[model samples]
Target: MRLTPDEGDLTARAFARLDARLTRDTGRPVALALSGGGDSIALLRLATEWARARGRSVLALTVDHGLNPESGGWTAFAAEAARAAGADWCGLSWDGDKPQTGLTAAARAARHGLIAQAAREAGARVVLFAQTADDIAEADLMRSEGSTLGRVREWSPSPAWPQGRGLMLLRPLLGERRAVLRDWLAGQGADWIEDPANVDPKFGRSRARQALAGAAPPAPEEARALAGGRPTMDGEAMVNVRRDIGARALAAALVCVGGGATPPRGARLQALTARLRAGENFAATLCGARIEAAGDAVRVMREAGDLGRRGTAPQVLTPGVEAVWDGRFTFRAEHPGWSVEAARGRLASLSDADRTEINRLPAATRGAWPVLIRDGALAPVLAGEGVERRALVAERLRLALDETTHEDDLISATR
Candidate 1:
């Protein structure tokens, strides 16, 4: 059924609300992702009229995920609706083969990709999504139910583009409820596509949506806070500054030992560790070697894994420094606790698979190992035939304990 011109009135109002929410300034185009669903169709209809009033036009994009067999038919319906609404409509399709993880995440990623592409093609700065308050509330529920705080903050600014990606994602109707959108659409005599999968229990979001259908609607302020709508500065600037400062400072603090193979320990490492914890000049990499910041000292070990275990070592560091085991212990420059020659020999003794495993790690993790570079050559501790690998491990553990205690002291000092 064709929507009459009279239906354009309600849509226009909805569009105005969306516009006011997304764009406070004028003379800019707004791109709408029209899904041929009740919410998006209503959005597109109103957006067109709203744009007309501002001497602009609506750029509508319909993404065909191809998940449903009837998606082609739906696409045609969406295009026609766009035409009726007087929007410059475009269609996008996805062509990726199915993955083992099923189609939901893939389809969402594809849909956003298409929307971004269409928005870019139209030269539109802001791409509007019809997500509503219910969506936010449901996500809130999901977060509250989960134990991991990591999952709650994963909705980062979209990385779809290098510069304008932030503009590519704006949920204008995010403050509205699904029922409100439906009511507004009904007033326009409009209908929308109802995907059966939306109600399927197997999908976590589907279940969440179903639960949301019965819950009391959220307050506007609560929704706004969850969506990060308070006053803010440039997040990109903050992140870049943090990463650069942290990385460089850490790099500078690292002390090379065992002919530049092993890292520093006791006081030298502790000083570096102090700066790292203070969020000051950090110059170390956690990806390669393990570093522990203790009271006024930092300890470095060449081997540490996710499970918090450090393997055997003579603890070779820089060319001039090495911690050697000989049933009796000593620090030497020429013999260097463990000789640079002995360290090189140990690395050569490793099997091909062990070498591959070590090499596969990132530079940060690999740097943490008890290996050192002597004149640009790989060097590792030979584990001093009779000296127990367990002794070196015990010393590393003690350093870690000291680091923890010092970290607590730093925190207490700050407080």
Candidate 2:
């Protein structure tokens, strides 16, 4: 349903409140991912107003994924909209060759990477997305169809660090419907571009959206429940407080600790949960992560077998370009051709002091710990040795754990 004028004002006020909270936590300006779509354009407009009143900066970043012929024009249109809304604007492009298969997934990853990079360069720690209630409902429907996609949290730490650079993605419009946002824009005499892909039945999201036409939108309570609680993870284990959390949060934790891109199967996760509840000491592996039950807690660590199976292929680390090696650590070397590989076997070659220092980490993590090589010899660079390195997997685990562990505070703030 369309939003009334008063409802639109309330939505703007809600955006302002959410933006203020994020700014306070991150202590940085706001960065909006603009796409010239109704939801994003509305966000740009609202964010511009909010920032102006608070004397804060708002950057609008338009990422051209270069997938469609009209993507360039779309970027230009987004730029114009941002400028009209009194926000600083920048255009980013995904320049590399697109993958033939999984084009949508590749383009999405590229878009987020480019946007995160731009936001970091602009000194913004929080990137705002224009996802609305309608989108959330559609995603829920897709999940019900066994899509294996996770729910989008209102506040999420970037999964890929260095490239993401510790940026937080904030979806402030999750409580607002898309039609309401469009109506608000219409009232303001603003127009938005309707991407042709939105109606294409080949896209799963498009099909889901079509299926949602006569379906009742997700209830507010259900949406909040689906948003789930924050995660709590100790260095070695994730505390699974089942009643306070959901499968998606657990899956995210497993993926984060497992260092795998895809999450474990839902059935596998459920079985693990049952085992944990049964209070049986057991060990299982899924999604490249090893889960070991230990007295009411489940410890998640990188699977050694998976690491060994990855083979000793050293990835070339280029200067200024961030790369996540082995899905464990994000690193950018000062020089080119710096090959990053597992620290296994090579740890003995290290000096006594270096070995001692590296031993402080968990034994399971040591095998996958980043070790650099240059000219076929081990480089002296280590994680804390003035090197640009971010433990992405560990960071994700920690953040997700923290969020779930202290979910009450987060829920209270949202209320």
Candidate 3:
């Protein structure tokens, strides 16, 4: 269904609608990931209106991935569009020369990398993408080959930098039809440059875009409904989680397993067997540490990080490291090599309920406790007195393991 005109004043109104949907859960500044495309231009025109009305700022960003010679020109056009909209704007470039096996994936990686970095520099809270419902529909169809489970995420933060931490990488137009955006832009007499690569069959998203061109748009409410429920914690709680564990740590708990070494090729799948053994929503893909069900087993693989952060630094798996940011806290094994610290924490003894509650804590009341972890285990016992007594019993055993544990550590040794 086409979005109603009254629902939004201009294309920026569309952006306003989207921002409202996304920020309903996260109250932060919205950074538009602009590319001078029709959809993005439409959003820019409308976003500025919305931002002005609400007394907020809209950061216009364009990522120039030098895959095509035209990318430079596109970036310039995007800058002009941002200026016309009166938004604070920045343009960033990416050299696509770094050899990558997959062109589409690599370009996407590069694009997101530039935008995420720009958002960081601007200190913006959320990065908004002009992804339409058509994209969602294409992604929905692609789910057959693990595309559905792979691409469709309720929420995805920029893994490139923690700066985009808790910043929702949102598809504000996920429920809107592309034609509506096109029509809206046409109504405004706004012209946007089209990327020729979009027609190239080599790019997966291009293929999806082509398929979506011939399809109908989904209901905006339907698309919004897909995002799931409100978070248990507030902004502060989220900030704490990002601070203590870093976003990757909690992401690891949800997607990765404890292992000293990288798994062979798709080790993520193998670890996923544990999840599949328990039954979960993951699908088959070697995207990162997260694995999906394929046949009787799962595929295991290293998880992907933000392009800017990837291939530059070694992963840290330090135990007992805490990241405190924006009033929220998180604890995790920071050293990526081998962790012995997660074993030392007394918080591991807490009942699952207490752990869940702690993890669900709001950002406002994080206090000094800050959800501590060491190596790879929770340390509620050491952090506070509210921990379950049963956890204290396990604390003694964990402490002994921390003391006497070695490379050849045995579970039976503690017992």
**Cα lDDT for residue 345, candidate 3:** 31
lDDT of 2 by residue, 189-281 (tens): 898999989999999899998988756566332223433454555543233433324566667667877666566767888887667666778
RMSD of each: 17.6, 5.4, 14.1
Q: Over all chains combined, what TM-score does candidate 1 have?
A: 0.51
Error of 2 at 134 (Å): 0.8
Candidate 1 worst ten-residue window by lDDT: 231-240
Better model by lDDT: candidate 2 vs candidate 3: 2
Deviation (Å) of 165 in candidate 1: 3.3
Model 1 C-alpha lDDT per residue in residues 1-415, reported as the tens digit of each score? 3444544344554565555444433454678888888778767766777677767767788988877899998999999998898988888898878677846656766676667766755666666667666767776676566511111111122223212222334455655667767776876578788878778888767778878786865643311111111111111100011211232223322311111212333344455545655755333434234454434344343322421343334345333432343211233444323332222234455456556655554333343333332334343432333232212222222221222221112222111
Model 3 Cα lDDT, one tens digit per residue, 115-189? 876775565655667776776677666554454123433234443423333344556566567787787677667
Best by lDDT: 2
What TM-score number comes out for model 2? Answer: 0.79
User: What lDDT score belongs to each candidate, Candidate 1 first?
Assistant: 0.49, 0.70, 0.48
**Each candidate's clash count:** 42, 7, 48
